[model samples]
Target: MIIKIFSLNLRMQGKKTYQEKLFACFSLSERVPKDNFYRQLGGVLDLEYLYGLTRAYYGTSGQESVDPVVFFKLCLVGYLENIISDRKLISHCSMRMDILYFIGYDIDDELPWHSTISRTRQLFPESLFEEVFTKVLALCISKGMVSGHTQAIDSAPVKANASMDSLELKVPKEDLESHLQKIRHISRMDKPHRQAKENKASKTQQTIDANKQELGAIKSRNKNWSKNQDQRPGAGNKGSKYTSNKTHYSPTDPDARISVKLRQSEKTQLYESAKCRHCPPCHHRYSSLPCR
Candidate 1:
């Protein structure tokens, strides 16, 4: 009985090997289900007009650019997938059969280079993008996917690539430690153990951008924040100190500004993209509509 069981176990064990083979009949359209989200989206979204609208942007005598329809579909995929990086978006699309079918690419076809997507985006004007957006919004409205009754504008703090340790004082001559002690009370745990190896911010960025009145307001706020924080439980263990963009700038990323969330003791450096502001309030009013 034991020998028989051992033989059966060996028979069940398997190993996978790599091999390549050509198929006589294979189709992406057939493989993807009818109810797939990309398939449904492709059915409802008609981007054929993009060719005529984008014809003026291209000249008659140069290498052909990326298909405007494909480019816009790629952008839509990126937005729907919440992929911020073009390289990652292309990589993601390559692996998904449904996405490939929606974007009109076969499994064997090579995708456009990620850099090409970036260049094409820069080549197109903002008005073209707005027109595309308007068309999609209009389609949504027609489908009862968006109602014009309510508007929901929302924002969240996205962490910047910079680190808190890379922060530098606006006034170069003032000692950071002495400055912190003067403006706000710091517990032993709140003290920084290390300093940035180098300051990369330009002289202009290091200069104070805030006026005297603004500086005074920030100081007053910092003092009040310290007093309020001391009364909270576990305040002694919190390492974050009140930081304002007016007084400090990130040497690693000059564009990053310091921000903190309500009821959160930790500070974060934030850098919001200008693209988020492109959607006007009038368009946003229909954002709360229900999809049928």
Candidate 2:
């Protein structure tokens, strides 16, 4: 009788597992070079100015608030790193030694919870953020990185999430007093822009003429409502391409406007035409019936 035996082939396999390390030398600052960009930023930026701006929001009797400077630094890290999600920003910062050093945190220090970042963001006024932005911009200008001259703006098309079929005719402005009031109220509730407007009123007014020109262009386009079906690029489907904001408006959203590519070439104006001789029903060429 032959016996069949199974032997396990287990030597040493590298598998992922969790283990507690009894000892380790951890120094975040030591790991990060002195010439690192974050370190350089920390050295150059004097964030103590923020404490005065943020002081009124904190109570003297309550538990300590997150350091205003550190909070802003964390926000800057998120912006520079392009980490839009708050949770991911915190996670990313936690993993980077340079960031920890920049934030003045020790290796073992636990970063503030993501919710804290959100709450702190809400608590601060927009002026504070603007102040930070202006300071950084001025610094960049001084460093010759950004020219404080004429700046050009650009945009790309983003398909709307809402359906075009839900569009409705716009109500006349004279009939929208209540609607306008509601919109103003909603705008007031959005603290950031409101506060920024209050703080930088003069700067905003300086661009009024430019804004008016843009508005006038939009108004002209809305009024004209040119047919651009043949001119629109990548128009694989057949239909009208341009719709006027004046003639058709989306009642579902006051801000929604139909946009089309305005740039066109003479080639885009190509039209298809056909001509054919009319034949009689009896298969003779145009016999007597006016020969249309």
Candidate 3:
């Protein structure tokens, strides 16, 4: 049998030049697909009631604010897209045709400034947000997307804005040295550093409220934690020693409390440095211990 060999040629296109063009017939609604998520969401979600709900929050005079419906739609987009930053969310929304259409803005129409979104969010009360959430949840329930019978709550600890290094020992009525000797596992090599630049904590917060029994328990837990931590990698790292909310607090954020969570597979303890807001007394009591 005779054999034949074939050669294939591939064509490479040249660099394309981009330029802006004006078109009178351009329409954002037509550009986005009918089945697009944003399109369907926009069609089903009616947020016009927000005008009446939030009318009291606005003034009758002065400059006009961002549309309530548009602002909320942008927030919904951010939540659905998992965008945590306002600046980033605005930039991302500006780049998407579907998002612009969903928010009722044309290609040339400018989205509200990121700061406007933040200010608008703060302007609305928590009750307003809850009401909006309830309405959305009801919509979902009606659409058969939610069972409305059962709900699961997440108790995961979120990382705070405070740093571990900024933690300061809580002052007790007793001598400072004696108190430190009781609770802290001070390494010989650990050098003393300058005190916190500022202590924002009130006088009541500065003093340790934990009783002797609580202090003793903390001391015992610190000793064991220090011993086990020495076996782990980066053991000598600063801030590796266990510090409890019962003994230490962040000077930068007085309300922030230290929380710990353990990895099941590695059996290693991970500390969520601090909480940005004040937690309840019951929450603070359990937050110091390692969460499963």
Candidate 4:
């Protein structure tokens, strides 16, 4: 109700900031003591508290003027808000009223430039993100926001980090099978999209070689199993002319399965023998999880 009530005198002041308006929305700047709202929002999160926690955990060495917390917070702010691209995120903080306010900046405050963001990220490892994330989640638990209960257990299609088009498949069902066929066709075409992406040559070469190696490993495993097995356990889960990626990559073409097995595990793995695109292939030699 308070958010809908705009206090901006556009005729003179142009507009009140989203941050300011947001604070007003929660009555953060009102007669209620700062402690009351601060308490309600949770706990004190001063610069020292932020920096100390990060400094102790990150264990970085050397002299630096900028606080590590600012860098960490910037990263948190970026990802949590679903602003995935760094450059676009920087641009938002610079121009967007709501972002600047949330990050403790004034309406006309100068936010970090895109280059600053690029440079700051170089200082922290990927672990820093996970560390800070867990801390936040713990706080949610402390506030009784999460139960870690089985009822809370759920699954959603986490699209492969691979482009959506890269996941195309085709089926003979002619009914809805045509839709899958289009997906498969599209994914095949999208392969070159990643190639055009100006990725580092070394990284690209490494990825290509890694995939090739994985394909070989999968082929070898499948060959040995086929020679010994009367039937594959996963084979029972298959539909006519459609093998489930739920366990392995069954291309629209059946022969492709001989060389490339797609194991779609809940472990977030995508193993394609055709190209070695493995999503954290389970490192278990005997982990009872079936191979396609």
Give the per-residue Cα lDDT of candidate 2 at 156. 49
lDDT of 2 by residue, 1-292 (tens): 1232222333344589998899988777678898899998888887788888788889879777789999999989997897988999999988888999999988789999999999999998888789888987787668766542333333544444333443332323433555334333322232211121122213222122325565566445433332332322222323434333443343333343455444732111211222333332444443323321
lDDT of 3 by residue, 1-292 (tens): 1222222222343578987767566889789999999999899988888999999999989999999999898889998898979999999999999999999999989889999999999999999999999998888778877543333233555555566555665667667677667544443224442346787887667667668987677667556654655421121343444565666676667776665445522211233433233233345444443332
Kindly report which residue stretches of model 3 are placed more than 4 angstroms away from their true locations once superposed: 1-23, 148-157, 165-242, 250-292
Give the alpha carbon lDDT tens digit for every residue of 40-127 in model 4.
3323443345666555534357644444655655676676567878788877667644444445556555666667668666756778
RMSD of each: 9.9, 20.0, 9.9, 16.3
Best by TM-score: 3
State residue 155's C-alpha deviation in candidate 4, in Å.
Answer: 4.7
Give lDDT: candidate 2, residue 146. 56
Sorted by lDDT (best first), the order is: 1, 3, 2, 4
TM-scores of all candidate predictions against the true structure: 0.58, 0.54, 0.61, 0.39
Error of 3 at 106 (Å): 1.5
Which lDDT value does model 3 have at 1?
A: 17
lDDT of each: 0.74, 0.58, 0.69, 0.43
TM-score of 2: 0.54
